[model samples]
Target: MFASVFVVILGLLYCRKGSSQSFLGRPRLYGPSEALAKEVVYFKCEVPDYAGDEEIYLQLFKVGDRNRSLGGYTSLRGEVGAIPKVIKPSHEGYLECVVSAQNNSGITPTVSHPHYLKVIDPVKGAEIIHSDPMEFYEGNALQLQCQLSAGTHVSYKWLLNGQPVSQSPVHYAADNLLRIDRTSSKDSGSYMCMATNTFNKTTVFSSNSSEVVVTIKDFVSSPNIAFTVLKEDSQNYSAVVTCESTRGTPPITFSLYNRTELVTNMTTDDRQATFKVPLVLDRHLGWLQCQANNGERIAYSDWLPLEVVPAGGPVTMHYDFDLGENYAIVGLRFYCKVKKGSHLRYQWFLNKTLLQDRGSFYYVANEAPKQSILLLSVGRSSTGTYHCEVSDSFDNTTAISSKKHYLDKDVLNRLPILLVAVVFGCFTALILLVSICCCIGVMFRRRQYGEKSLLNLEMDTMRAAYEGDLDLSVYNEDPDVVNAARGDEFDHASEASVDE
Candidate 1:
């Protein structure tokens, strides 16, 4: 009979182990699977279908020390199965529970499966660490580390510009570190790190570090210089020199040098800087140079020589015209320049009268310090003599004027006198020719009709006075020739009358 009872008990135990559902008197433990270090956690062990008067005890122990209870609860009627525990680093292991009851079953104990209890230290004072002088050059490596003052089982993630850093081949994140193998100008902005740890599968604690500013700069190329010369007087000059780089970052330092001696230096957020230099005659200015730097490298521009030229020389003037399809002048321009001068002033004149700069009719175009151009739209009003006067800025006493240029040879003032003189000369010559012809006619008449009588001349003179077509007053200087012609006419008339 005892053997049969023992076999029955063993069969009952085997059946309970094989079933998917827990037996009626078995205990089930429920609580948080993980807790922070030094935190309080509660564990509840419930036994289904227990009587009120039964005495129950809930025992907690580590999985490896199941024979000894670390802490327990004792109560009658199985009503005090709720247990409290303080989690510590020493308690970081699998935990288990056993519930024993004294009732009709007489001190039967049910053991639960192991529950993993992860003990973690809460995160505090999270921060991001990087090298000093948070400036980097393009194509260089950058490293960042996320750290916490006290934490366990922590995870790290990187953020840029308040957003998650996108995954790329150049970006790496592992352990507590983030690395960028290749950096570019686009990588410049605010950077931060996030530290997190899982309390349980459903709960997480996180802390964010303060943002850090990172700047990426590009290497500067070779520098270049541009300069302009302005003459202040005959012996003094000034120049404006500009230094620039085509491709580089800002906050660049530009240095100007005269040979090996530094003239001046300037710092600006732009890529270009300007400087002023003075030049004096009879004094050496030295070779000019420009240099650029941005904390990474230095670059230099080509050297330039500084020389001062005096503002005096011979002044000359010339003209150019544009013609239309019909060969008519449409536009005219007069250019006046000095052969060699530095700071010369120019003035234009028309017909010895100073010309004012007026639009379209007359104006000055491209009026440089040493050269000037007078532009005119071809018209009757613009037709006149024009000239230019050039002088230095030292004093108004010394000056030079160009030769005269005339649009018309006979100006308005000389036209009438030339016309009257030509007319009077022609009139006098015509009267002389008439007098000479008369003299020859009279000599010819005297030689042919020398025997003619004075009585025939008196009769013809009376008849010619009656004929109005012949005016005998014109030959008053030679009275004999007039009388000879009249006598011939009278003889002809007398012979005709006789023949009739």
Candidate 2:
């Protein structure tokens, strides 16, 4: 009888269900399998036969610890419903899932899959707004498509200043007319949009667009300085004249002429603009005129005097800064860049390299990236070499440049001062050259006199220094000089030194 009973017990144990049991439904706990515990997390569970009218039960247990089960706690007990409830997790650990079928055979509870939950800090709210095409050309009517792409249902608010611009003169709501009727230059300024969500709120505004000068008779102020290509076929030669104007009601119109023909005519809503004249011979080098009118007043720019550069000189680059303007804000800004070319497509270079500028200045205008403009907003980092280069299939040349180092120590207010310094520096250098030539003539005279005076090795080196040849190419083999020029230091000196 004992043997039979033992064998029967073994057979019963062998008949136990598979180790992994699939619980179709019976309300599983909200375990993300691994989720942010304690966060208002949504959980759902499904049972196989707990159909409509039949209710299943749920219980909670902390796995591995000696603890009583929280039975039938009533988290969610609907037969037909998928158990989905948002519950905050109590602790950071593995949550054991114990489930059982209700309204049935009262089967023993089966353990469900184990899941680990983690709790973390909450996220900040969103009321941050960033929009492209922030500063539009004035006078065309504003179309600001405002939207808060993020935040916790942040409330939206738009303001032109401290005043609530909730309505427009032409519309019932301030949101419409992104339009300004008879737009004028005085209307330009910063536009700020605000959005606030539940968690956090912040604001961003476009840089002041006061520079967005608009004319009632014309449009937004265009680049006053412009250029033309006269006698485009001339042998890589051209004449240039800088344009300037003193008075006018903006929306002023000016045309560029190639002798008797016009190449480009531009209008402005503000004070100044530049025009470029193509490289040409004598006939094409006529007066370069800029005319400004806004229906109320007729103003003309002084006829720019022309200079024809010699063909043999390399294409030169130049730059200028308009610091006298009181309205200017940033210290480092590009005011103007003039480019001259015969063959190469024009491209601007910063620090001797090409760059498609993406800066505050770009936000101010819609001109082509290929065309350069004046920049303001100067900083320490803004100091560098800027130039324009044009090239052809055969050769490329840098035609214009404006360097930051052109001024004297005290007269650093403008580049023209620095340019004068460079000229004086060069002139000084030329005089030194002449003196050296005279010395060489004297040396020949001394040699003819049959006495070696002062052309010794040291003297030769000193002469080289005065000539700006800073090379340390020394021959220690000279019996007269060694200790002062030997070993590792001498080797380094010779290798790193420049001859000029």
Candidate 3:
């Protein structure tokens, strides 16, 4: 009986001890390290929804590809803590961290989902600022500057028209400064800078490909070959050319010069430099050169040819359109616009004939003369070659623009009324001339011998068809004295008759 009790007690004690446990779960694989280099930020992981008693323990780790453990931690709590640890990567590349969980309930482990870290490279930016003198000339100097920022160990490159710049070894040392000892149009192009650097075995770069234009110190500008005139009447005005040298530094002014005499001037903006004038002067007939300087380096443009031509001819304010005159529509006005108070000797012409610009209404001077607009009512008679001539009077020179507009005769033919009146006027003038000569001969004859002839009266009236009635009666009058008085008396009646 004693042996049996001892055996039962031992069995109870053996059962009392805990020994039903499972091996640790398979290891979880963390994600491969990856970064966008521009947008990605941080990542991490740990045991999921953990809730346990008996002092749960956990570890953080990094496992090598060779299956050897590289990193981990101890004393980790198992109560919904240490999850998504928020890991940050220094550079762009693949990297990872591992978190492990443990508990006494089974002496096993649990793993949360794996995560990835990413980094991004941002785009670079640059700005160029500059200015030029109001009137730049040759032998001038200009200095230009550009600024930018990018990634570490970054190298820079400067380009003109997509080609790398070899000039100015100092500026080319590392794509930043663009020095123009003496600039010209050839230096003008789409300019840009590029930066390249390595970030965690990945390349990050930034660039700006906007254009920069270089201009020269020049005089009057010429009308472009691609120029077209609007329907402006005979008016003097100005033409403007944007002389841009976007690579210079500020407070620069631009000026206009006619030969050796200076005409107008202006300041510059960050992007564009401009030269404006009243264009009313023919000064632009010559090469217009734009010059710029940055107080150090000077630049100039090839002469640009420009002309200050009138828009059209002058006509009555309300000329007779006569209903069907469509061809006369191209030109609407004539103007004698004064671009500058100094160049105000505004003069215009039609077919070499001086336009009668009386003091009251023929011309207009404006404050903003460079871009001034002129208007003069136009008519068919005024629709011919017209000229806009301007002189500073000081240059001992003149600028002129002559242009012609030929209305389609076919269009004018539609208005046969005006043509008919012109032709009839000419015919009447011819007849009057013939009548005058004949009457003179007759008067000489009548003074010698008093006489009357029926044929003479008929001839007088026939010729009078063109001459006035007074002259008609004189030639036929009682062949004598009353002739002179009759010439005066019939004058009014004949004038009325001829008008019809």
Candidate 4:
């Protein structure tokens, strides 16, 4: 009996000791619900019977990853802390903190609820979006939208001229869009959109700024057009017409018209346009005008008249020479007539030598299509066969006088002595008087030559009335000399017959 009681007492004592060792509560881990990368996080393990000298350890595990811990198991005290500096976006998964407390009696381990850590990156490529009609008038409504290429959750603020925009009843912001009820000239300035979010807590991302310009315009008015003659000639003509509206909205259309037919059309956003007519003919001659339209109003310019003359026509030439009947001693003149031709060239020749108007002895007195006069001061050197040669520069045709006329100084010298002697004898006087009378006779002869020279000038004036069928040559030799010689033979025969 004594031995059985001693064994019972020992078994009871062993049971009590084992129950005291197992009396510690389960270990509990305490930490923040969320953490950021590279931030220090502290975790604590609690035991109902924890001792200051107990061995405690901490470990972090990523949720859904059973193969490894975020940070390898770390030996620590009851309270432990860690800094995950090299954490990446892949480390943004759920995180769990496990803590174990151990003493000489037993070990107690506990795990914390899954915690989420956010790894953020900055927002990039911010932008703005809007519609056309970039230019607006006062009292118009406007809307603008701002967006970002990155970041899901973002807050937007409007800025004007790099300053926070003041909110008014007419101007306000809606999420990422800015709206204006009635814009005014004060609203004309640069606008920017700034975006901020949790991902970029310390930094703000901004979109490229946009500009708004407002104006007040007047009613459309008549457009002014200026006409410029670029090139013009008998065959072809060219001109440019420019039109502008100074007081109207842009996108103006201009139309150029010749008479009633449209020649060309152009449209421009700058409220001005130019029309060019490069090559126009005689048929295109008429009144021209331009019209401008600005969608709301139409205006017309003053009429501009264009005239073109036709070129090229038939060519004809008529000419004659004047040698007085008595004696062309003073001077001689030649006349040429051209009709039904344009761009005609006249050439005069004396004995087949080209006569130039530069010299004083032979010069062109008057040059015209109806009549051209070549006056030659009479002298021994002036005696030459003269003829006119004409050319039609338009058709490149040439014509010469048909009949050749002759002038001989010898003929006048042979017949002039008898008349002079008879006139001088009728005025008989003393020897000295006779000498004076001879001098007077010489003066009279010179006056006669002067009168004969005027006769040739008169003939030149009358040449225009000469019939075209009459062949008259104003050339090198006189045909009348042969006729006069033949007449002398006839005169001799007639005198002999009378004597017989």
On lDDT, the stronger of 1 and 3 is 1
For this target, which candidate reaches the highest TM-score against the unseen true structure? 1
Give the total clashing residue pairs for model 1. Answer: 0
Q: Rate the local accuracy (lDDT) of all candidates.
A: 0.78, 0.45, 0.47, 0.62
lDDT of 4 by residue, 350-438 (tens): 78878887465778754644445777666676666767665543322345342344445565345568887886776664667879989
RMSD of every candidate to native, in Å, equals 23.4, 31.2, 27.6, 35.3
Q: Tell me the tens digit of each residue's lDDT in model 1 across 1-500.
A: 99999999999977855441233366677778678888888887776656556467778888878776767887676564778887777787788888765443444577777778778877778888887468878889888888898778888888999988886899888877888889888788999989888776567778889998999998776788866665676656677888989977888999999999999999999999999898664355778899999889999999976654445667788888887655666778889987665545678888887876665488886556757999887777788888888775444555788888877422422447768889888988999999999999999899767656776788899898787877777656677877899999999999999999
* Candidate 4 worst ten-residue window by lDDT: 308-317
Report the Cα lDDT for residue 404, model 3.
Answer: 42
Runs of candidate 2 with Cα error greater than 4 angstroms are 1-38, 41-55, 58-139, 161-163, 171-187, 198-291, 294-500
TM per prediction: 0.44, 0.23, 0.24, 0.30
Better of 2 and 4 by lDDT: 4
* Model 1 worst lDDT window (10 residues): 16-25
Give the residue spans of candidate 3 off by over 4 A.
1-60, 65-293, 299-500
Model 3 local distance difference test score? 0.47
**Model 4 RMSD vs true structure:** 35.3
Per-residue CA lDDT of candidate 3, range 249-310, in tens? 45455555555555555665443555554444434466566555445554555565566433
Error of 1 at 360 (Å): 17
